[model samples]
Target: MATDGPNLASTYEYVIVGGGIGGITLAARLHARLPEASILVLEAGSDPSTHELATSASTVSAVRSNADLTWQLPIEPCKGLGNRSSIAQVGKGLSGSGAVNSAAWTRGPACDYDLWAHSVGDQGWSYESLLPYFKATECVRGMKINEDHHGYEGLIHVVPVKANWAKRTYPLRKAVQEAWAQSGVDYIEDGNAGDPLGLTELVEAWDEGKRQLPSKSFDLEGVDIVTDTLVHRVTFTQDQGHEPRAKGVELISGQHINATKEVIVSAGVYHTPKILILSGIGDPQTLVAHSIPLVHGNPEVGNNLRDHLSVALTWKLKHPEIGLALGSPLLTDPSYANGAPLDFIQFGRVPTNLHTEMLLTSKEDKALVLRPKACHTESILLYTYMGPHMSGVNVPMDGTYITTVTANLAPTSRGHVSIHSKDPQQPPKIDVNANDTEVDRHILREGLRNISKVLHETPSGQSFIDSQVPPEGYPVLLPDSKDEAYDVRIRDFGFTLDHPMGTAAMGKVVDASCRVIGVNGLRVVDASVFPVPIAAHIQVAVYALAARAADLIAKEQ
Candidate 1:
């Protein structure tokens, strides 16, 4: 709300910090089930309604961006990134990263979630068990998904590109399909059903031409929403020699809001653990260092941070005047500006021989064993020029560029997000540890090569493409380029995919029901609770997770 308002309750049954998707889902579900239960969501950022671009999909930058809308977190120098640090765009508004992320609704493979159930020892967390929750979140009408795998009357609107649909027939769609087919990557009709191991039509979280904001997508009536408010720490009502029970939260301004029953932390990956640490729920040594008396110590609170790091490799189209790309006269139909400019998304793996050659940890081995054929590389196609991805690569803005943004989906690299101070306002230190292992570097390099193979070696690609647009000092890296050249491009220009997770990991920090270990009446209900990295856009899985988390909360009561 514009202000906390005079009618705010002195105490609520539930006080949730961070009104992101998780907060929204949990509040909406709980309130709907128990209409009289008092619920309050404290959000540090303002209402997304004030930001027009938060819901606009007219440009390639549809990954919602309004500088004032995010927590501009900084990363430390990484040995893998050639000591170059990049800024992490973390969403701070009510919808969280869903407000600032590339809105592709890719749900990843079933193995990604099935493995979670195996690792966490919770059969209920398996893909089959969680299918209903997944179906409950998205309204998949007109899209041909696998049998019994989706819902029709869900909240989030989803639509896939069809050849006959208006403005849906994008140029290069045929070329991309034929190119991948020629490259041995056949097409898959449904990427969200169980697996997405091949070329699939790009499905997004947009309806026709507009993307719906989280508040519009979910039912959150009669719930109190306090915006532009910061949470200082979770307060506990304790008796000595026993675990503390969460009473409520204290705001950054020293104002106290009480939760009679429970307090939930739905802050994003980076900030959730920071809040926990500030609340005396982290490692005792660290809490002592910060001069904060400890209530409970959980060393794993801010560890095991995992994320996807990607890089853009551009290719200049052989023909620009033909008007296939954005900004071209022939494409000025306005309808073409509807969703993301990309036509298709391909998920595959690097050469298996390369993966087997590297020394892997026990965790990586077991994860691979469960996800035997999990996607390791994901490539996104952009119809317009993305030349600014690299310096010295001078290309005109005449719409001659077609880019392939590739990411390492199954990265073995593990990072961390930790608090350096006791202050809640200070953002956590995020070390994504991009390309930390040789395996990750090669996965990224080969991912780029896989995209390049469609162009450099395929007949369909040669029909429309000309040459690679490499940085000024380097030669164009081909599909069979040496490991050294691929390494150079990756180390110099790799960027975070902005999909971070694993901080307050499930098995380590929270129990199967998302309850914080060693504490009472407190839970973590966001990506931070994910035990491992999900190999897709993540927002879909997060929504599914929220649905299940809400159910779990209801059952416990």
Candidate 2:
């Protein structure tokens, strides 16, 4: 809803910036607990509930390409990816990335959250501690959900692709499963139970084929939602002999909205730190460079940025009818071949000979290398068309190609997000620094090699593959190509899985309760508060985190 002058003049008990997944969820939870409390939400983009692209489950491409629904931010040229600059697509509306993402509702392994809790020295953040919240956010449908693992009463609906639909759409489902089994990968009964080691049908946050946006799923009754508004910076006040307390927020229009109780910043990874930096709550050096006076010297505000660096390997299908062509009604499952369940995406591995060779050639630090205890690589098969549409090859209508996207799940390489100027309208400088370390490159190279091997050597995989279709401007690596060739290929084609996080990290920028360090009455509740990147699709985690944050905030109040 549009905000008027009168709305801006009124003060609220709680002010939430960004109206995205975390912000909306927190607002709904707070309202449910304290029905008399007044809450205000400021969103930079239009409401996704009314937008067609945001609500359509089949229009995945449209959500990514639509300029109006996404913040078309560009990353700074990275030496890791051959000094190439690429667009970082962050959602711009009320639903945020949840509205635009591929709708894969897989929660990562339990070990990932346990590791996170250990890293931050907080038992409350552990998987077991947060399991109730995870269950509280979703109502599983269309499948027999384990009562011990899933919730029966929740707003968001989670469901598996129907068996009839999967059978009709994926003619090669059985063959693919057999092929994966032949390659030594087992079938996971349910990926969400936290053991995602094998092939499992993906559950999506969809109801009746329509995207269930977080904004719509969460009840926003009695909440004042201000859409098409940009939050310039948070306002803070310091009384005599008292700590600096957050007053509210100032808009780009120079209007002030007062928050009598607290201000919660949930502007996402890229913009959450951007807002904090703009408010002078960043590194003193960065603030001085941008002529922004330092309010607090939290050097870790925008550092430790992490994301899944991915490269796609495409192949031509000999039997087009077996592929997900003709706008298939369902996409069955994606599997992880050889890695821990904590690894975010599904992946396949190469033969033992190639695997040994790749490991022998590696010269990275032993600590950085992924061992059996830690997950390094991840992969997932895409049945539908991928790559540039203008290339004329691998078109959805043509039904000739399938793609496998491989990635480094637990990357040691780190980057930062900083502002060039004090203007919030200008996008932040996001440098993921992908493949900056030898270990990251090694993992990605091996991942690509393994996926290629599965498609070429496996009986079921080979039966469907006619040939490999390299994207234009990419070199086709021979089966006997050197390891350097695979490295070069990864550098040339790598992109983010679009899961950017760990900017305002926990235990550094914020405390265990998500309250910002060195500040009172202000908190950051979003992916930015993640101390480390969780190895999975992040939406489910975000929902669970927000649910936990709401409880913490409510208890303290």
Candidate 3:
């Protein structure tokens, strides 16, 4: 299945940059809507041959495997994280991050979409307008016959947990539900059904125990896909010095692929803004400093960078089964257990009553929720995901740690993404400035405290936990609490969710229609255009946005 050459070397009606969820979803939608139009996707990295790179926790692990799917570019050092420069993770192959993400596809509360639409002044962007497209991307498999929020037929597969698995995670969840009820927050059957409150089982993207890819499901035969191609810059033609009309895209290899009607930038938050700045459509001051000629003076291009900061809290469990290792040879061995882990479970919650949830847990559970800030800030929990197995931690030879991680899904602090140089090959400067906001820091602290409470509530609780973080009870932030020092202790250990968004904000840099303000034949359809980070995981929202963009682009064409 080696691709002989660029799928469509020199000509295409549409050229999409970045083949991740955003790009692939649009590619599929375009083929379904416009069968005759030729589409080309340019990815900078190589195709990942194995799912390991796609599923690994470390960003570098994803890029290491596929030479054709990942190309390491030198990023100018970031100022937020002590002036140390690091490489940013971007997809270079067909499935993009869809191949590597944790695969939790949760649609954030509908309120987020409504707010986004209002901010952008687009009537077509409300939750109602976007729901159909959400349905279009999902194929909910094996659900209750009467499940209304689930989809019947769609390209991507949605797999819920099996009966036994759901039962196992139920106790932990039930404890939390009981706690939330005491706090006066009612539970809902489905989080995606308009209101997201209380405990809910997350919907994952999987088919027969493997990750789902949009290319296979979305494109039965119509779309032309290209991997190993990087879009260096967007080519444009100006008319009367008004809005610039998109012509095509220039590849990293210097090949120019034409976009007959329009070129949509579906790269995710990091690369979308990078591409914009490289194309000369960003903050003129930053662009000028990088020595790049300004194409459009949109100062908001890379500002308002926001992401959910995540930290892992771990504990040693009483039962070894609770911390069974999926990657262990006994479980993952081809001949043993059919390559299934002894125990792998996930339970989700939409924090409606944050205060009471924190108060219910023991001090040890609080540590699991939010690690003492003075301890490892990079991770928040001390998880006993696996222990004392024949294989140590079941980790690969690489530097990846096979432990559980939890991120504060909503962060109040905002950051920025700016261009370091005019060169597309050069990575953009990413300044998350994480935890700078006291509100975000306090929220994370509260969230950790709540999770810790859940850990100590039942047999499902501390039984599987190996150790408690902070070696002390949960950190307290209340005004009357005598432990004022705990507040300072919690702030020191905050981490980044690695989920950045809001650059090239919807109403500010781009209109509600996703069209770049003051520019024509150009639009940003990636996560960058999200005015604010949605309350749930970002992957689903990115796909939904791409689907919506395809509709807008097709109508105009």
Candidate 4:
């Protein structure tokens, strides 16, 4: 099940593992830096999808489940969450998750990059230093001065939505502005130039009228983008004194890849640390428990996992007229198609070092505040072509399957990733530990109340009239008043699974350079390396992190 890779076994200078955005982007940079260096990228996914219809959806349906891109499922059950672990939905294809993710090209405040550098103690990783790279990869559309915040000419194409769906979704931006006005925050038209305090329409990665694929955006020639090849282990050779030096990796089918210069690990957060531990480079206790020998005793390898926990506050729309239903009759008309329905009311802020926000606060108010801040708070975003016209009034069990979801960025609770087995096929134990930190819970509690306050405003009535499901009927954690109990009930069941970050965190286990501590020739360049989750959607930041890492790797060479 392996594809032929470029002939780099003879004179290859670098052999990168994983061909996601990070690997491909780094290959481009590496090609520019050491043009003469032969680079081979080993991807465990398919080449790329060319189906235009597959790229138009908002959820996982946008992805084509080809054998080359989908990897083996998790081996067995995990210890956490009552041992009911699910299969991780990450992309294994050439472009990786970027190929199937909702194409929202959001860049949080510049402070996010600065925070990353400061946390890892990496010199020159501040926003000022990395701004050029962020701007270098972006191609802004729709707004003037996009060049000021985005790159006018870049390999990846960035386009704006001009359909009716976008227009209907645009009003949510105004609603959030009016909501946040009560809290005394200023608005910024562009969130990428730093200072993401207010509401703005997000920019997404798309072509002139469609989404862009990594296959088309990257330089695929010469660079061997091998798909459907699963790397089981990083083969290491002991040095003169028996120290482990990562030489290369071995595929599942028994093909050995030898690295001439270096074997860069960009297998993302979940697998990166798992690979290190299997290679004997994690906590001594964890290694011993899993019956694996220890290489370096870094207790922090799987610690410090942070994610932006989201809680949603959904309501049935009073009239189909408030959103996208008004334009339903014109779907067949070419001049009026491709429009977005629901509006977004997202928010974010620094985490408080408390135990939990939802636990300490009243329920009803929690639901209200979450409507504007905690869950889906995007400064810049995209309007999907999908419409949310429900055929009936049945409430969905899936918290956000068809409703508005608000999010809380910066959580105080810390989760962890641990290997259940030493086998490469086994999935790591990923317990989100959501709502464990009082500080994080409090933020959600407060955020919910704020949003509830805004929904009571004049313009908001058009959307919420006869649409809300009251919290008064909730079984437990009931509040005395309508507002008090609203947020609490929402907190109890309004959980979100988006924005998982930190597993193999930077600084503690991996150094400021994203290199795993005490390990040679190994590095992480994904969401796992984030010391903490940034203030916006992590997808763009992950790309930026890869960009910074690529430059660092080049400089080291």
Highest TM-score model number? 1
- Runs in model 4 deviating more than 4 A are 1-11, 51-54, 58-88, 160-186, 240-243, 325-327, 330-345, 348-402, 458-464, 470-492
Per-prediction TM-score, please? 0.95, 0.90, 0.78, 0.81
Q: How do the candidates rank by TM-score, highest first?
A: 1, 2, 4, 3
> TM-score of predicted model 2?
0.90
Tell me the spans in candidate 2 whose CA falls farther than 4 Å from its real position.
1-6, 162-168, 326-373, 389-397, 472-480
Q: What lDDT tens digits, residue by residue, belong to model 2 across residues 225-261?
A: 8888899999999888887899989999888889999
- Report the lDDT tens digits of candidate 3 across residue range 509-535: 888878878766677877888886676
lDDT of prediction 3: 0.59
Which of the numbered candidates is closest to the native, going by highest lDDT?
A: 1
lDDT of 1 by residue, 317-380 (tens): 8777632554577467766756777778899877766455545656654365235668898998
3 versus 4: better lDDT goes to: 3
- Residues 1-557, candidate 4, lDDT per residue (tens digit)? 12555333533567777877777777777777777777777876666565454355432443534434444334223222223333445666767777766566666666656666766677466777777777777766555554556777666655444323443334344554555565454555565566656644445565533556665676656665666666777766766775577777777777788776677777766667777777788889888998887667888877766655554444544443333332344233432232233333244543333343445364322332232232324322112222222111244333221243455675656666778787777666666566564555556665555554445444643443344444345532211235346445434444433456777777777788777677677777777777756666666776667777777878988
lDDT of 4: 0.58
